[model samples]
Target: MAFLGFESKVFMAPMAGITDAPWRTILAACGAGNLISEMAAINAIQRKNPKSWQIANVKDEPYPVVVQLVGNNPELFADAAKLVTDLGAYSIDINMGCPVKKIVNNHAGSALMCDLPLAAQIIEATIKATPLKVSVKFRKGWDNEHINAVEFAKMCENSGASYITVHGRTRAQGYAGVADWNIIGEVKSAVKIPVVGNGDIDSPQKAEQMLQQYEVDGVMLGRAMLGNPWLLHRTHHYLQTGEILSEPNASQIRQMLLKHLHLLVNYYGEHSGMAISRKHIGWYVKSMYDAKRFREQYTKLNTLSAAQDLINEYFLRIEA
Candidate 1:
């Protein structure tokens, strides 16, 4: 099945606050399937918020960028779709997968899963507003007791969703426990629309396994790609050659981390970017030599220079 008119089959999931422009560019460069921008708030966009507009813009991105929007109001969601499509997104995705309190309390996000009819309304309205292809990312249901991915996938297809992404956990699960791939397979079986399976795809082997076992149209990698952009390239290579790609050495990992920090600094400025990089710093240093000590020191670093120094020192110790 074609995605946003492209034949590519892998996607970097629209991870809120994580899949930024730099991340999209790096993943696209490494042969990631069509890139998905992080989710933008429909309410923020409808209010003409500057931050929301910037977050949705993707005109200069290298790969086909599919913009994801989150909101409860059908009309507002439709308007946001038009706005992002105007900004040159190849497609627009509705976020019915987020389980955050702010979004769910507003009847947006995975809360829509609790009401499939309204979820269909949102999809219908968004599809009518823009010529760009539309997709929806949703959880199994509000909880295990309310599992309805099959029913929800059908509703999305009937309402004109061009594709569907099923995150196997429910709203109540919230990244806890193992993702039940069986639910994702069930959703794929229930829908004629292209189904992309997401959740727990942390390694290239797991990616290939998901593709082989579920027969999904695509695999979307989320949290696993953090501080590991090479996963995109490695997964793509393994898919094509049937051989596992070697993992990056500690030095290589450190370099990637530094590159990411530089890009983030360029995109968000030093102060804001450094704060954001802290989360990634923690991820990159894990399991490496002196990682715990480096993490402790890095957490206290407020300047880019200090962070760079700490990284250099940590790697130096590893080499020594």
Candidate 2:
């Protein structure tokens, strides 16, 4: 991320269905340098998947956004890149790291790891088709049977990708065990393009550790920032000033959740908006006292007003 000359080091990884415009816009305000949209299926985009179409909209996005696309076929993947570039993405990211059954079974995602030549071809086609900058996200390899991130990073660089992001886990590892920062360090050493290190970065200290230990250009946070966009700003501050910032208090957390709800309603209409808002609110309250009670009450909220009223009541009690 920083190697892309990003002013901020904290970046939000693309999470399907969860990292939409409303969420990206919110994260952007919290000092996230980049926002990556969830991976859109190449077939879906080529066939004009209405759901994918809605998710790819970058018209009113707050800052430079990179849309990630995934598929096995080089032709379809190339077409999808062209489509998103026409939609005004700041950049395009190819997904070679997804380990899902559908994605892998289709010979895409981590499946591409089995064939480096084909993976290189996909990168070539993507670079040829789009005017936008190209980047790649991938696991170390299909498994320990073939760990070749350094060579793969070279392939991406040869194909004209601006950068590479390594997750530091083999496809076999899934999200299971620890991410080998040493592997990320290896990939960084092997490539001229910037390497963005992403794995289980849960806090600013861990982010600093990634920079110091791995020598990566930047860090990407996926699940760790679930209900805490403030992590981005805190991470940026820690990197620059070497100081830790206080976590948001209950009242402030409530306010941020409410602001998110408002954005969701503005973006996705009220009925569906309130329903989706509950999930995020649930994540926010999970670490608080009486979390079970909060989730139980919050789930029953069918309207925005009902949910906001309950949230206000909960925060008032804490503030008092």
Candidate 3:
């Protein structure tokens, strides 16, 4: 459970295009025990793709950073793992849980699940390439007809992976149906290494349930943490104590949103930062009254000051 020096059991999953430096910084501040960098392609990193390099950046984060790499080639995986290790990654995570079409088509991501030998090869190569702890994140199977998570997890453990994380859905499910926590439990029973259960853990209660029901060493949060980093802290607290903490109030939510915007702007310049902040703003207010109208108006605004004014106005109206 202490892989890569992480003492806390709650982790933030590596979400492509979402779990960037700014967001990871926010989540770490909110008490995430460990953070995974957005998934970067091995080929892109080897080619020195600027955006891929940017995606692997984990500067200024307080917690341990795990750089997740996706690829089919063992040599490329080793090269990419070394790159991230030089960048100060605390550990390297192999991506076999991503079900995106482009990634799978390239023989990466969940596609690796169908070819267990190659998956083990990539894990072994990466582990040999760096002293950093190497881990693997994978799904239950290629589909419901092919549930191989237990077999695949044992292979990964045998190939020198320090830990394993299982997302309770098959590749065909693709975020559509409920995650089968039973499969996660099965994998946990099969592996001696730490197993982290992922998928459908959107709340503190569900997180606690995953630990109890599945008997996992930890839980990983993905979409659930979007615009709601407080989930990490709350889940941690709930697991430590039997009491549930109150949700963030209106003022607290507004303040956090503003802080997120500033961090985005500081990391990315105003033009691109404000463009991305719109989506985050939408996530933050999705449950608010008149949210649809507010999102429509908010997305059209161009300047940071204008966006700030509108957020203030919207919250004032909510208070009224």
Candidate 4:
């Protein structure tokens, strides 16, 4: 069953530098949920920044793309909503859950949680700007001392948001401490719009736990998904079949790493692709034999062919 035009209820939470076009294409291969682009600043979109536009681009993607925008200006958000709608986004997600210092210093991202009236105005402006569904992603609250997930969720719904996603941590938490899933439930109980829970959902079991325990409509997989592209497919399969699929073996991991590298090369050209592939290469080799030593050597590589040769030899030695 489709949730918001996606094949599954699970969602890929947007992460800067990681959920680019090449990564999404790889993560969508075996199974998929709603795929979100990295958050693009509304200011950049309005200024017609090419890098920002490329981050939000989904023209050739085969699946529905949810473009997440971050900013506090209502007028700019309205203008951005219009631009993404024209660019063919399936929906626009307002980013009120980001806890980055630069974003918060600008009164955007999770910082909007502290200013309810302004947040409402931004949501309302974007809703009126386009025909596409508009959702808002936010945290539990500005902090523990000012818990307001329920209030925040209600504000979004009242302002005409299509749905809401709660990243069960407060802005003050900044990815530390356990995510308070109960706050997500509180938001769910307070709103008529569908609620999706985010944060600390690293495995399929955790994703299902959010759905069944908190009664959230869906779950968003975050940072834990960095090197593990198959996580979306694995979680989706577990939800539908109640089966625990095995993690990819070394050989299979190699195949995916190469596949991702190839996509980055084709999409961004080999020069940039090889440089970008290093981080993923580190992730893909996690827990493999001699991984620490291999990573040291791989980092010195500057070309795709060099990386490929190293990977082939390293994985073969592991298999042997």
What is the Cα-based lDDT of residue 22 in candidate 4? 91
Candidate 1 lDDT over 134-161, as tens digits, reads 9899988888789989999999999999
* Model 4, residue 305: C-alpha shift (Å): 0.4
Which rank order by lDDT, best down to worst?
Answer: 4, 3, 2, 1
Give the number of the best model, judged by lDDT.
4
TM-score of each: 0.95, 0.95, 0.97, 0.97
Query: What is the per-residue lDDT of model 4 for residues 241-315, given as tens digits with 9 covering 90 to 100?
Result: 999889988899889988999998888898888888889888888777899999999989877888889999999
Q: Write the per-residue lDDT of candidate 2 for residues 1-320, one digit (tens) a residue.
A: 36565666767888886888888877877764577887889889888888887777686775888899898888987899889998878889999999888889999998888888999899999999998889999988878988988888888899888988899899999989988888899999988888899999999999999999888888998888888888878888898889898999887898899999999998889988888887888788888878789889888878888888998888888777
All candidates' lDDT scores? 0.85, 0.86, 0.88, 0.90
lDDT of 3 by residue, 62-145 (tens): 667888888899999889988888877888899998999999998999999999888888998999999999999999999978
On a 0 to 1 TM-score scale, where does candidate 3 land against the true structure?
A: 0.97
For model 3, the stretches where C-alpha displacement exceeds 4 angstroms are: 1-4
TM-score for candidate 2, please give it: 0.95
Model 3: lowest-lDDT 10 consecutive positions: 1-10
Candidate 4 local accuracy as lDDT? 0.90
